[model samples]
Target: MTSVKEQEATRRLMVFLQEWDSAHKVARSHILDNFIKSNDSKTEPELELEFSQGASLFLARLAAWLRMTYTYSTCLRKLLRSIGIFLSAASGHRYLIEFLEIGDVLILLEILGLNYHKEEDKRESVKLLQLIADAGRKYKELICESYGVQSLAKFLATSNSAEAQEDTQILLDSLGHSNPKYQNQVYKGLIAVLPCASPRAQQLALQTLRVMQDVVGEAPTAVVEPVLGVLRSTHLQVQHEAIQLLKVLMAHQVRPALLEGLVAFLTPSCRKELTFCSETAADTATLGLKEPKLVYTQQAAAAKIVGVLAKESAEVAEELIQMKVVHGLMVAVGNLDHVASQRYASISLEYFVHMFPFLEECVKNALGDTLFQHFMDSPETWYTKMDPLQAEELASIVIDIP
Candidate 1:
């Protein structure tokens, strides 16, 4: 370890480099800039010469200081950000990569771990991870094997910070870019984090999975299963996020067993919401006052699932048509808050009108002509400006009737 006095001297030296404007010595500054701008491949030698010319001692001292300072030190962190700006430098890139290999990553990982205890430190940890990920992409094999991966995975597993989770996704993305060899490592980390991850993390993980699936041609069934399991997750957001990912897996043409399991894992309300059984089919309307919030979420999730299913399963679409979802929505339009309730009821209307051609018969049977006349008669009740879309959809429905 460097002595405290030496450390202070190095700290002062780093400060000196920061304030040492090359304009103070224009000749040297021009020489340095020219060397960097040189397109000649042979300029590498001259570039090194220029970089070494006056700042050589300063650069050497700075690199030593960086290597000496604890990774937790504020000065060292600021220096890393400074180094990050010059990472495009051929020599600078090589030097930073070398530094990463020689314990820089371990230190960074330690900092990332600190994110759990210190909210303020989380951003620094994310920045460090971003730098590692940006540079590590070029050195995939090393990065996959680096301390950064384990640290990142561990942080991803536990850190609640949205930024940390997003950074972890980026880090995994970089790993995916590096080599196919790290694909399983990335998948493993995601799976490990899935059950405990925050809603945002879960969403980002699904996004990462989608990109990885494209990159790797097809992800392993093992990978797909864990994400499929997220549908059964207790978090409503996780359930919502899983919908699209599950669609991807299904579209990828998953194994029948996996598909069956995925279908089974679909929450009961989600399944009910999507299938839209006959409104007259006591089973559909009998859905009593279950949690009102859940009722709304179930309706939204169902509508999305129904839309996706309409593209694939005509039977499911036919079932949705029979369920009189339009009537149910029109009814819902009157029950709750104007803004949120109306928004979903309007969406349900859009899906209803667009997806089901036999919408009139379904609506008539579900809401008998008497009730239909009442609803139509109460035009003013439906006239709430909160749901202009509902009005538009209703008008379209009325116009389509022969």
Candidate 2:
């Protein structure tokens, strides 16, 4: 059923496919021309079935060229752009499988790191890689084997494009899940993004890091500093994401850094006494927090993090006690005007009271005898006092109520 004109086009495609190693750019471009559009008079299935040995030869040839070329060019970009088009058709699933075999996954990842390409070009590469990554874990591990994780982190940290950064974040999230072989590398790569210049990257990194916690085996000692460094971020979401990551990544070495970071958020006097590894982080902690209530909000969040950590591990509870995390919790409970700070701090203190029993007095001291009595009788009431904003901001651990 191949039409005369269609057969001629297919002949040219077969010739181009045969001369792939030496085919001129114009011939390559023309073959890819109308084929890129799925709505062409000749559909992918038709071209694929009729183009002699199948249309995937086009993909194989393209991948071979991408692997061999070290330089970026208009032709390369067009080829890269055409990849997604071909790889998306209904018949494209097999091509996705074939792409990994051709080493295009590695080549696409390398494009993310190369300097000559525009961020858009890099994103196209990311999109293609993301398709392979999205296929499932086997494909994801192939990307990891190709050093996909390191290249992904570098892109997230360096790209000025938010869309590109966010797209890479999704790729990383997929890569990190259940792929234990590469998770630690993925973890390190994301942690490196924590201190990068872009808050967008930092936020994206933290978001992905939160997903990685249950899978990543041991929290590396070097991770503690960069993880703590994010606490000083002006973006509350970034700070909150860091706190979420700490809940699972809390190693013995992490104990003191977390305590110090939490204490720094409590009071101006306390903040001045503490210093993070970065001068900018220290400065952001010291000078960035001017609003009094915002400081109270920070206290509430810290109290919540401490509460969760203490509830989970006896070792963590012991560390918090040694660091006088009780005093910080007490400070939060004393901020009565902010219902969130008082309730979260008091709830946090209950973890210590129940676990260590010695910190009951700290709760009584901060909440007074009457409130402390009610707090012990029914802790759920403290959760109720949280208005919608308070609950949304500070209640990641608390149950959602209508």
Candidate 3:
């Protein structure tokens, strides 16, 4: 049996939805005023009741307007936009959140991602996302895991409109900044769309990956291969974004298998040529080339793998060195020609410095003279307040000739 209050609320929502053209303006103002009053009220139940009534009415109006090929009126559209902002502002209001069903949240998100046709409407969508983003961890997983992220990523990947793409990325990135569970799920969806994704989609994916590092801390080794695949993309911008993502991953450590992959791709021989392949076609008045295919070198692919390994503890580092990465970075750095060839050469050296006291002999043979000084000079920056002399001395001992 439906509660009396729910039945009454439903009636009010229907009235608002039906008389939107005439009553929406008055209804919108009444809802806004009620929201303000409720927020300031001492009674929690009153606040909840007030917010639920206003939100339901606003949602009804939006749903009715969206059902038609054209909006009912400009006032209705503006009211819809205002409601989105109100929800965003009321994000932290416990009452407002409780009043929001999953269906209510989805309605707002759909407006942001799909329903809005005009640029102004799209901007309203961004405002809605911004509101949810502002809600932080509170409603993050609620909005994200419920297929909201997948829909947003799909829109971002397929939509050619620049404003829509930008809004989608902003929305996705904001959500990605939330809880780790949501970030991981959203990232998986983003990556799943990679094959047919446009340059914009790929760029957004990379951006999302960087932000996700905050949520997930260091990215796991599992992300290495897919991230490397991005690095090998034919689009220059995609490559640029991939490298940016790689830099963030490198801040952590790397795993052995991942390190091997980085070492292989960053080798000198792999830099011989650009690896993308493009085929051109001639139209009546123009010639165009489709986006080229990615060609992975054992080297570019290794960068992400190396980064994953670099985030591990000393024991893991020692184990990986035992597997030959210590020699690989040394070889890459020693050969000036190969220094630039390795995408993460400097980063590898930084990771190597941590292993100095434990693996003095291995470092001595690998790091060499000039590289040793650079390490000594830059030692303090990476390790915080450790004594400069200690750092330099360690560098000297480790990078000394075998």
Candidate 4:
């Protein structure tokens, strides 16, 4: 079933591969010209016929050579790119199972550790890893078996290209969802990226972490500081996501740090600990209430979190009372300019006042009897995600405490 041209091409490739090391440049040129479509000067049908006759054997031989070369040499790079071209062909996915069978999955993953290679090389490795993972669950687990969780995490954190990081996130999210065996490992890896210097990297990590929350179960204590640290982000989406993750990660062991960190957001030192995440972000740490409209956003989100925590556990409520969360809430409640902050601050304040009524007189003293009455009876002001007030009109509830 073979033609003279096909057999002749295959023989040349095989011959070239034999002396490939001693005369790598010549051999590489011969192999590329004979097999790889772009490098081949042959007409399309001629090239197609030759590859059909020996794609499998050529790939197998290349992979064998690929496995034998541990370091990133020019010859190895050429071979790797050739394989990528094969994998990227129109019917490329057809070779995916064969690729896995040939031990290319682990080989490609090993290539990722060769940091000296161009990012293009690492990205190609990831692309192959992706194809392997996309093949099915067993292949996904195979990646996990090959120390994938750590490797992918390091790549995600360290990859300079945003596109590469995004691809890495997709791969991680895919792996995290199905591998029950490696779910926790994946979770730990994602958490490791949260502290990375790139906000985009941190954002991508958080997005994946959000999807993984329910599956990973109660998070470890290690998740506490970095996530709390994320709340300091000026990035609203970042803070918003951190809040969502906190809702799931809550456990008794983490509550002490969690509560203390949340209360610290209300403390007066907010700007001191404030890390600029976005143009609109304010300090969540110790900047206190008087900082700015930006600070109001952080305090509002922090207060909202406190309200949810308090509503869930009376014991948490008691602890927050001891922390004097009321002082910050009062400052938030008085901030008439940023009603978004006022709305969230008042909700948490209501929790403190309702659950521990002894704080009522102090609350009344802070807001005056009229504002206190409005806040308690208020429909629009009492709960979550309030709309911003119109520039021309203020909330009827805004009243100066006498």
Candidate 5:
């Protein structure tokens, strides 16, 4: 049924393929050069169409080629480059689906697990997998069924490159969104990458966790310690992101360790005070302590988390009160040096007052007459100057005053 023109075209295509598989590097290079040159004017869709039309032939060749161990790095790179190009095209998914149909998904995933492959090659493989997953929901589900989640997690845990880790995080986030059943695996993957030396990975992990928090549920207790450790990170951005994640976790249920960690931000001297109390026993019992230096940003974050947790349940409020968190908020609001911390403290105090009105005497006592009088002097101005949400909280307090 083949026309003469079709048979002639097929013959030339076979010739090009033969040259690509030549043992001589020069012959392979020449063929690849011509292929690239011929495709220079082609758009991705055009390239996709060209590849799709030749899918059966190219896929069969690729499978045999993948089975052979390439002695030449250049040959392997060229082959990977060719596959990468196919996956990168706008209609790459068409070829990807066809490849998946023949169980080539495992072959691609195998390349990701191969220690012998160059990181560049492995990254390209991951990209191809990412493209397939991005193609459609069914592809994502197929990936999950293929244990793609575990492979990606293993790579994310071991990969040295931040860029690779970030790309992996994005892929996992997308896949997690598509397949809720695999979300726990996704959560574990994010947690596995959290302790990586790369700040970007840590940030990405935290960001993905924040988005998936509802499905991920309360973070495993194992992660709580490490996440708390990130709070002390010298990088402000990492600290801020970590605080954001902690806030999310706190909103679900107050973790004692996390609350303790946040309280450390508010009162870094607590450990020293406890140590001194233990060391000196009766001698230091009556010692007057100086206020610890407060990092305003951390103070604000701690106060916001406390406010959120306090409003969540009466039991949490009672726990925070037992930890004397209210006194810390009082000290922060009373500190006139930092307006932001003052606003955060005011917000936390309003939550406490709303939840436990009997705490008014505690607040008034903690502020003392001097600071309390100052707060009352221009309460309206103070409320108006705060962020609208905080301002609303403060206004409510004013309205509730007898």
Candidate 6:
């Protein structure tokens, strides 16, 4: 079965593999340089055909070399570069499948787990993994089955490089689309990175979660709890993103815990407590007190979530009413300093009145006539920019209350 042509090809491949495994850095470089140069002029088909003969053996040797090389060794980098070159040469689904069949794909994933000191190496590892996953759905499924999603998540959570995280996220997203089975794992991975000190990681995690929300469905309280904590993030964009995710999650299923969390933000006393704590901490900073504060945007977001929840059903509205949310809404709407919060608060109030007409008395008592007059008299000047019908509806609620 061993023809002379096959014998010569295996011998040449072994020579190249031996050169790659040499202890001298120059020998490894010579092999990589020659390999890249030789492949430069070859088309994918040509490269595929040339390598198809001894591809499995070549990859097996490469994997063994990779396992033996120290993560930070120049030899490891050269080996990775050589693999990348080979992958570039074999750029087709067919070759990708061939590589997968021989366990090279798994080898690439294992390389990713190594604690490489260089960010470039990390990025390159993730890039190669991404290339394999992009080859086809079957490749993606294989990656997921091998715990690729979990590995990427761990990498994402710990990686300091934005480029590396982005690459990993792309792979995870691809796996997510290729198979629904990995949704929960993907979700957990994204959530695990949410609390990372790196803002970019947190943002990428949020963005990925937003895209994966439909597939993720109702996340566990542990997952959702961190997202809620992200609401307090100093970054405005992060806060907005968290709010958007919470809205989507709430829309899918009304969680009482989420409702309770949103309602807490609507409380004026709670906001004041935050402010008071902040001021007191500033005064006592010399004594090591920490400042705690909630931005108006957060309050606005909470009110918006409330409006969305109330619009879902009368029972939800009644739930908020029972929580005494009307008092908070009244305070928010009458606070002219924050127009956005006022607007959302007004929307929530409208939902309350429309859902449970009896709550009108509670709202009326909370606002009193003078402030209610201010609410009605200068509708044009209201920063919320309420339309005439909306303004009228709000006015009708207060006016017809008797």
- For model 2, residues 181-245, the per-residue Cα lDDT tens digits are 88788888998888776778988998887777667755667776677666555577776787777
Comparing 3 with 5 on TM-score, the higher-scoring candidate is 5
- Superposed by TM-score, candidate 1 places the C-alpha of residue 307 at a distance from the truth, in angstroms, of 2.4
**For candidate 6, lDDT tens digit of each residue in 147-249?**
8877788788777787888888887887777577666777887887776555566777888888887877766776555675555455666666776676566
lDDT of 4 by residue, 127-226 (tens): 7677677767887899999899888888887788888788889999989887898889899999988866566677888888878878887768887767
Estimated TM-score per prediction?
0.54, 0.65, 0.50, 0.65, 0.65, 0.69
Question: How many clashing pairs does model 4 include?
Answer: 7
Q: Root-mean-square deviation of each candidate, in angstroms?
A: 11.6, 8.5, 11.1, 8.3, 9.7, 7.3
Separate clash counts for every candidate:
1, 0, 22, 7, 0, 0
| Local accuracy of candidate 1 as per-residue lDDT tens digits, 1-402 | 978976766666555555553323344344334433452232223434534333344434444555665444444444444444343344555545545555555555566666334544555545655655666445555656765566676776566677767767787777876577777777667665554435566667777776676666665666554564444333566666666666566545453434443232223333443322222211221334344443444444443454465567555545544454444455445434333444545454455555665564656554446644544455334325334454434422422232
lDDT of 5 by residue, 1-402 (tens): 988977776777677566656646566556556655666445456863554446446655655565553332455655655655555566455656556666767777777787777766677667778878888778888888888887887787667777777788889899888577777877777776665555556677788888888877766776665575443333556766876787678666547877766555554333423111121111121123222322444465566668776776677778777777766665555445556666777777677766777776665654446545555564323433434443333222311122
TM-score of 1: 0.54
Q: Write the per-residue lDDT of candidate 3 for residues 196-314, one digit (tens) a residue.
A: 34666777777777777767675666666666545545455666666667656655674444444555444434332422222221111112322221222224334334545556545
Best by lDDT: 2
Alpha-carbon lDDT, every model: 0.51, 0.69, 0.53, 0.67, 0.62, 0.64
What lDDT score is found at residue 4 in candidate 4? 96
- Alpha carbon lDDT at 303, candidate 1: 39
Off by over 4 Å in 2: 1-33, 39-47, 50-53, 64-70, 75-77, 88-102, 135-138, 249-257, 264-274, 280-322, 326-402
RMSD of 5: 9.7
Angstrom error at residue 374, model 2: 20
TM-score of 6: 0.69
